[model samples]
Target: MFIKNKRVTLLSYWTSRYLLTLMIGLLIISFISALWIRHTTLENRLEMIEFMAEEMVNRITDVSIPGIPPDERVPNFAEDRFRIRDMNPSMYIINTDGEVISSNLPLEQREQSTFSELINEKEEIRKFTSAKNNKDYYAVKKKIEIDDELVGWVLMVESKDKLTMVKQEYGQLAILIVGLALLGWWAIYFLSRRLAHPIKQVAEAAKQVQSGNYEINLSDHIKEKEVYELVSSFKQMAGRLEQLEKTRTELLAGVTHELKTPVTSISGLLQAVNDGIVTGQEAEEFIRMALVETSKMKTMVGDLLAFNSFAVDAVPVKISQLDIDNFMKDFLAQWYAIQEQTDIVIKIHLLHKEVMISVDLIRLQQIMTNLLTNAEQAISGTGEITISLSEKEQYVSVIVKDSGSGIPPEEQELIFERFFRGENKKYGIRGLGLGLPLSKMMAQSIKGNLHLVESTEKGTSFEVLLRKEG
Candidate 1:
């Protein structure tokens, strides 16, 4: 009944080490208990016999007369004159010559050798089994004396049937102990199987997963809540793996399509030049167009390489502390000079003019450059790009906000994923979509995070959080 699923054999469960050890321990305890009971029973019976024997000696001496032979001096015990207390033993009187003078034994047993052997015996107590009746007995002897003269002996003989009855009762108790032990063994066997079955199910599920089969259904196997949670986690992991495989397939297709465009264009241009389709100024213009396409392809290839390197930590970070206000002022000046843009209004806001924080200067600059590039592309005409810096308790924040066409709500989260392109590609000749993802990776390597803080139809703001120096 314990093996409800019938996954393992009952014999094997019972033969497990846990149940075997418990049964053996119980058996040993029962045996020790039986031995102790037998010992205590014998001690109590002997003590009772010793105390009864001592009392009989005192009674006999008080009844006897002085200066007379033990035979005639003592009145016949069978008569009412001299009496001894009878406490379930056969009491007897014997003279100095080993002949019975008086006895409580049956008349036919008076002349028996079993009775004759006990007369005038100096021993305190002896055990004997009678030859005629074939029954066990305890015999105790006390001397009968008058005024310090030894007259005769008084003997007390008791049957051992009571002791035998005590042993039989103990035997019943041993049987009960054994019965209870067997019951306990069964209970343990079932309990152990209950505990082991859940673990076995988990092991089987793991084997399936190792073989690339993640469709494990543990609904039928109910166990503890924790085990259920483990099964649930495995299911979730399998689903994620499936999604990743789909994404990988899509990435391969996209790469093939993107690479083919520039290569096809290059092949067409060279073939046109060889055919002499045009001459003079037209030829020069075609050569310049081809160079532009080649440059675009080169930039895409470079982005791919950078993304791959950042993914595996192949690029190194050089950490340094810099003044927040001064560092951003210099960075913005260099960026604006490089762009040579006169229409964009670049504003700067600083919570602290001189907040020093630790960062990889090169990596942080690259990340901010990527964000600014994305913002400039989003703007169609004259717009404001605001760079705000603030210090928090544990981190320093750098937010870049642009007054341009914002990202769509649905595409905000996926924009940071590798090779993910948003809906707004209006700037012409879109990038390979690795810039934001690679920037995010670089941020994470420095124990920081880069995220789109907010985006709406009005504008979008991106924030970079860096750990503040303690």
Candidate 2:
């Protein structure tokens, strides 16, 4: 037979263990306290009996005749003569021969031999059991003297049942201990439940997320700092996941359409030429159009592969030190030579100081190319693209500012997210939206960063930071 293990929840786990430990600790303390109270009560009772015995002895000594035997001189004690309020013990006067001369004991307990046998002559206080009544009693004794000669003992005997105060105290103590234990258990039960509640909600939320449901609403009004932070962070993460899911869906449709357009165009153009629909020079034009569509398709495919490789750290970088001023001049000249926009002007503002920076030449070229292309595209009819360079402490910044309408405020934060395109550019742009994100990734790979300094209706500015070589 297989034995299944029982699972304990957070609430039960903490409360049950704490209650067990608390109960054990309370039991140990109560046990020790009960013993101390009982011992102290018994000692007080014995002391009271001893005090009464001494009083009776003094009374008998005062009434005795000189040289008279205690058996004849000592009188029987009256119940009221030595009694202090409600406390009364049986009083006895015994001779030196162990014979009870006189006693205030009742008729049934007045046997002289049995009473004498119960007293210990050497002890001032002792407990003894009577054979006739089979009852326990505490006996306290004081010696009687006449003319400085020992006569007998004045003994006080009280039944153990009369000391019921100890039992009453034990009852009160047990009640107090049990009351405190119950109070502690109640506090722990509620406190453990309060602590476990939020964690349970978070566990359920995690399950929902695993099932691909990103919309989750968790309360953030918790007073605990750590739990509040946990709930707030999970909410933000769910919001981001929801946005990414939407972007992925849009990207799938966009990529399919972008790739299919070129393929369809190429197929139609080549088919027309082969069927002799156009003659001579017209046929050559048709073939040229097909080649252009093929080139566009190749560029798109190359971008997708390159992005995947860089994401996985499969791309290698070859770093080399280059003088900033000279490299910028050569790089801008080559870039300008390829651009067909004659109306757009490119201006350079280089720093007077010579700054040497460690960078991979090809990666830096790619970063500069993407930034310049973006700036060029942002401009409308006739606008200027300013390239300024500056040096600070241990880094150099290359700023590209364009006198074009700035990006919408809402789209600025998401510019560096993969597969995310701005509302304005999604329809007008033909390529995949990987330019800025890929550029940022490459910048980070080379120990640098790229960020937008500011963007307004006047223009937009982007800054690229590179570490200065030692």
TM-score of decoy 2: 0.70
TM-scores, one per candidate:
0.61, 0.70
Which pairs clash in the backbone of model 1?
A: none
What is the C-alpha lDDT profile of model 1 across 122-239, one tens digit per residue?
Answer: 5678888977678888787777677778776767677776543465656787788778777876777776666557666667877887786767766546566776777677667666
Report the C-alpha lDDT of model 2 over 1-470, residue by residue, as the tens digit: 86689788989999999999999999999999988887787688778778777876777777735432444444454535545333467777787766777777665666565556655546677787877789988878788888789888777777776743575788899899999899999999998898789888888988998799987878878988888888888888888777777887888788888889999999999999999999799999999999999999998888788788889999998888999898899998899788785688889999866779988899899899988888877888899899999987788999999998988997787788877777667787677778888888888888899999999998899999988897
User: 207 in model 2: Cα distance from truth in Å?
Assistant: 3.1
lDDT, candidate 1, equals: 0.73
Task: In model 2, state the lDDT of residue 34.
Answer: 85
RMSD of each: 9.0, 6.3
Off by over 4 Å in 2: 1-8, 20-174, 347-351, 387-395
Highest TM-score against the true fold, candidate: 2
Model 2: number of backbone collisions: 0
Clashes of each: 0, 0
